[model samples]
Target: MITRTVVMRAVRTVVFTLALPCLLVAVWWVASDSSTSVYAPPLRTILSRFDDVWTADRIRGDVVPSLLRLAAGYASAAVAGVVLGVGIGLSRTARAVCEPALEFLRAVPPPVLVPVIMLFAGIGDTMKIAVIASGCVWPVLLNTVAGVRAVDPVATETARAYGVRGAAWLRSLVLPSASPQIFTGLRQALSIGVILMVISEMFAASNGLGYAVVQFQRGFAIPEMWTGILVLGLLGVVLALLFTLVERRALAWYHRSRGARRKAGSGGA
Candidate 1:
């Protein structure tokens, strides 16, 4: 199963993925080796502080809370987006009724809503979660709507002719057809969720990665602030990889179908 070709391909993939990041790190290390600026600390100095700055206690107090909020918000957004998107996609009347409101809301930036949300939801985890959800929902909702609308009419007719109806039809046909677009929305929402999490935390928060970063900046802890940013970047990369794994698993059938189609086309050509 684990052939030399597979191993070599895996190694090549890893190298390609990491090449840019490794180069950037090397450049930063060399460039900042003798920096004396208060704002821009040496990369070595920043790396050195990782052990002391991001200890178990700090991670427990800050990073975990931020991640939990991000998860909650992202999940809530995904569910709401897909359900509402499906409904709107299915009914022309529903789409017409909701279009204006959707456009208005989407046009308004999520960050601007933070203060307004804080006014109603207060400066609790609720507000932060809401902020993240507000930003994350738009991408998924819009993408799901597009995906659903784009479902092949031929496939729909085929499914209906086979006595597939109602929820059975939806499960057997609609979801699978729309899943690729829905996944696209989800991928976009993830980055927005990360951004909103930090923005929300930066305002009236006691314990969160963003809050910790702000505290470090105010206290003139440059290295610690840099470390917090570094942690956030690492967190995004990890989340993205996890999402890719899930997407690949979920869309395995779609991928296979596309591959078959391509092969058929090539053979015909």
Candidate 2:
């Protein structure tokens, strides 16, 4: 099963994955060695401090809470978005009634809502979660609606003709057709979720990665701040990789279908 093409592709992927990061780190290591800048501490200094600052004790206080808030907010958004999107996509009346409100709310930048949320939710973890959820919902909701609405008319008609109805119809036809777009929305929402998590924490919080980063910066602990930044960047990468794996698993059928189509088109040509 391991063909030359597959082997080559794997090699390419590994190289592509490691190349940029290795190059960047090497460059930083070189460039920062001679730097006397107070803010831009040497990469070696950052790495040394990174080890100390991101230890288990610090992670328990900072990283865990941030990750938990992110998960809660993202999960809440995903559920609400998919449900509301389905409702809106299925019913013209619902779309007509809800679209304007959705548009209005989506227009308001997520960060602006942090203060409002804090005022009501009182600067607690709840407020941060709410702020993040508010931001994350829009992409999933809008994409789901678009995807559902864009389902092939012929497919819908065929299902109707076959006496398919209600939940069965949705399960059999709508969801499969709309899944790719829904996944796209989820991907967008994931990044937005991270951004909102940081914003909410930075805006108001006694604990969190963002809070710790700001505290470090305020105290002029530049290397510690860099470690926070580095940790966040690494977290984003890990989250993205995790999402990609989940997406591939969830949309395996979709990928197979696309591959089949490509083969068909190639053979026809």
Candidate 3:
């Protein structure tokens, strides 16, 4: 059963969440209604053309391939980053040995590496996925290391004292402590992956959303181009929302613990 307060809060959230977007759409509609710019099409025209351009064929050819590359790259980065991050975080020697190389690689922007990747992997899906993975890996790696290192020393000592040894100890204690930071990295990586996916397709792709947008712009299909841009924005928002839901579910315990701590502090005060 929902209380009045809960209902009110839900209503308020819905209003605040939707208010800005609706306002912006209203403004855009009003502002562009009478405009005659070739580059900036009217909002209504763009909306109408969205269905024509982003049809089933386009979705199968462009959107599906783009999503596949993003998923493959992001998953690979998450696994590799966590593994390497764990090693570096847990071992001072590993951290010292790898820090310089990792720093150098991370400093090189992923977009710049597209040419170099193409030289080796050619202009295939593999190259695109590699570029996305390269861009996404650093955030997760750095965040995981930071999270692991930030785990309470006292907790580690206590675990050691209690004979919580080996992989069991790491799985039970270390991973949970570091999960928050790891998730932070994953979130950062997700955005990077999306950016790289587009950039990769822009550089040397025959298909994908980015390629379509580029093609549309080159062909002077202003409304279609705008539609592509709008779709990309919507995709980012949708992916972010999905990730947030997953994060909340995965970190429910951490959230509850923090809430409990806050309540205790307030009570004491």
Candidate 4:
């Protein structure tokens, strides 16, 4: 099952993926080595402080809370988006009624609504979670609606003919057909969720990555602030990798089907 060619390809993929980031880090290392500015410390200084600043205690008090909120908000948004999306996608009357309200709400930026949400949800984990969910839900909801609408008409008819009505029809045909688009929405929502997580935490929070970063900045701890930012970036990359793993597993069939179709088309040509 495994071959030298496969191993080589995997190595090449890893190299290409890392090349730009590695290059950028190298450039920064060289550029910042001679820096004497208090605001912009050397990359070496930042790296040296990284371990000390982001110790286990700091991680537990800051990073864990942020991640927990992100997970909770993102999960809730995904669930709500899919459910409402499917319902609205299947009904012309519901779509028409909801379209205007959806448009109006989505147009308002999530950050601007933070104070309003704070008024209702208060200055706690609830507010932060709500903020993240508010921003993340739009992309997932809109994409799901579009994906459901784009399901193959022939497949829908076949399902109906086979007495696969209601939930059976949706489970067997609609959901699978729309999954690719739904995953696209999910990818977009993930980035938004991360951003909103930080933004929400920057306000009225004592123990979170964003709050820590802000405090470091205010206290003129530039190196520690930079480390905080670096940690956030690393966290985002880790979350993205996790999401990719899930997507690949979930969409393996869809990917295989597309590959088959492409091969068939090429052969015909």
Candidate 5:
């Protein structure tokens, strides 16, 4: 049976997908209406800069560095968040104490944290990665904790009946069951990670895409700044698409598991 809820959700998704590119183009067209030197670059002009950015030297010098920093920092955040989240989730006392602090810290904006991080780490790749990792970790940690705690008690008990316990139990039962939530957290973290990575570079750096934007802007290269911004936007879109594909595959078992339960319930009813 097709429920109104499911149908409406599908309709909304279709509407959103259709609306997004239209909105982007509309905004681009409006902005491009101006020929003024400071305000906006024409869409065609921004696209033209891609040839310069994607050149072998530019790719190696700027884009590659930014991407490498992003990946390194984000990867560290993922690993640390999952481990710490698992620890906190599994221990009630730890959760009670740590959750409040984490809550407060997570509420603090990452841009605010950059100066403090830089004070210690300085303006090197270390600072860049540290800032990104700091910004990204909370989402992953909180999500992992939520996921672990959300495991069905009945399923856990069943696993226990088969002698599962400790680390073995977590790997065999918990992570698999909690994977969907974990991935959700990861997707959120990556979003945050990307924003912070650029901001980190923009605020203070001699190289990277953000630095390129800054360099161009200082020299009155508005079109190049527009190009960098556009590339970042496209990068975000591509990354989100990749994550969605991974999410669908990774959560396939979880989806099927829930679907099976639903089918059983409907048959009984």
Candidate 6:
């Protein structure tokens, strides 16, 4: 069964993990054959560049800072999104005051804000993190609101009957119900985070996979450029799979308890 799951996962994984580069290679080979002399570097050349890209100097100088920026941005978005979502879901007054403004804010494209954000934040990690956070926070915030609001009122009443009322009541009754949606949001946000990280790096940074790619492209080092892009794409796939695993583990109890309840209900009926 685990093998089956792994195999199924391979299909999705390979598209990101393998197929893209394979496709790039096929494109390169074809284009190289055509006479795009300067533009087309074939598969072997790009493949060879991966070693240099992975060198300790490259890793330390570029990859560490990129990962740090992503972590800070993603973590900030997750925390703020979850907190504000919970607040919106739990309190009508707060929701009324905050939700519309948030919706408006979310509607504005993240890249558009980069120029404005950079004015205050400058072209550094701060601006990158802020841009990433802004881009990712919306999906998580909305998903969390949906999750909490969708919890059954009957369940809340049951909790109340057992004296589970107020904030404590919510912690016992609503949050568990909302956990799945929260995780779903986190997964979606993580993907968005990766995209934004790359975009931010491309626009303003001195280091990162995007920076490496841009630098190589400018210098006409086509293979190195491709290598940087490939590494970034791989990083995205790895992070997505890791988040999915975390989601499955976090919601395992919820799924089991739900299945058991449904089975018991069916027997009684």
TM-score of each: 0.97, 0.96, 0.97, 0.98, 0.86, 0.83
RMSD vs true structure, all candidates: 1.1, 1.3, 1.2, 0.9, 4.5, 4.2
Ranking by lDDT: 1, 4, 3, 2, 5, 6
Residue 239, candidate 3: alpha-carbon lDDT = 96
Q: What is the lDDT, from 0 to 100, of the residue 170 in candidate 4? A: 88
On TM-score, the candidate that comes out on top is 4
* Residue 71 lDDT (model 2): 100
Arrange candidates by TM-score, highest first: which order? 4, 1, 3, 2, 5, 6
Ten residues in sequence with the least summed lDDT for candidate 1: 169-178
User: Each model's C-alpha lDDT?
Assistant: 0.97, 0.94, 0.95, 0.95, 0.87, 0.84
TM-score-wise, the better of 1 and 4 is 4
Error of 4 at 75 (Å): 0.6
lDDT per residue for candidate 3 within 1-269, as digits (tens), equals 98999999999999999999999999999999998999887899999998899999999999999999999999999999999998899999998999999999999999999999999999999999999999999999999999889989999999999999899888989899999999999999999998999999998689999999999999999899999999998999999999999999999999999999999999999
Superpose all Cα atoms of candidate 6 onto the true structure and report the RMSD in Å to 1 decimal.
4.2
Angstrom error at residue 65, model 6: 1.0
- Tell me the spans in candidate 2 whose CA falls farther than 4 Å from its real position: none
Report the C-alpha lDDT of model 2 over 207-265, residue by residue, as the tens digit. Answer: 99999999999999999999999999999999999999999999999899999999999
TM-score (C-alpha, index-matched) for candidate 5: 0.86
**Which runs of model 6 end up more than 4 angstroms from their true locations?**
1-37, 257-269
Q: What are the per-residue Cα lDDT tens digits for candidate 6 across 83-143?
A: 8888798778887898779879989988888888899999999999998999989989999
- Candidate 4, 1-269: lDDT as tens digits: 99999999999999999999999999999999999999999999999998889889998999999999999999999999999999898888999999999999999999999999999999999999999999999999999999999989998888888889988888989899889999999999999999999999999998899999999999999999999999999999999999999999999998899999999999999
Give the runs in model 5 whose Cα sits over 4 Å from its true position.
Answer: 1-19, 30-34, 258-269
Which lDDT value does model 6 have at 173?
Answer: 72
Q: Who wins the lDDT comparison?
A: 1
Model 3, stretches more than 4 Å misplaced?
none
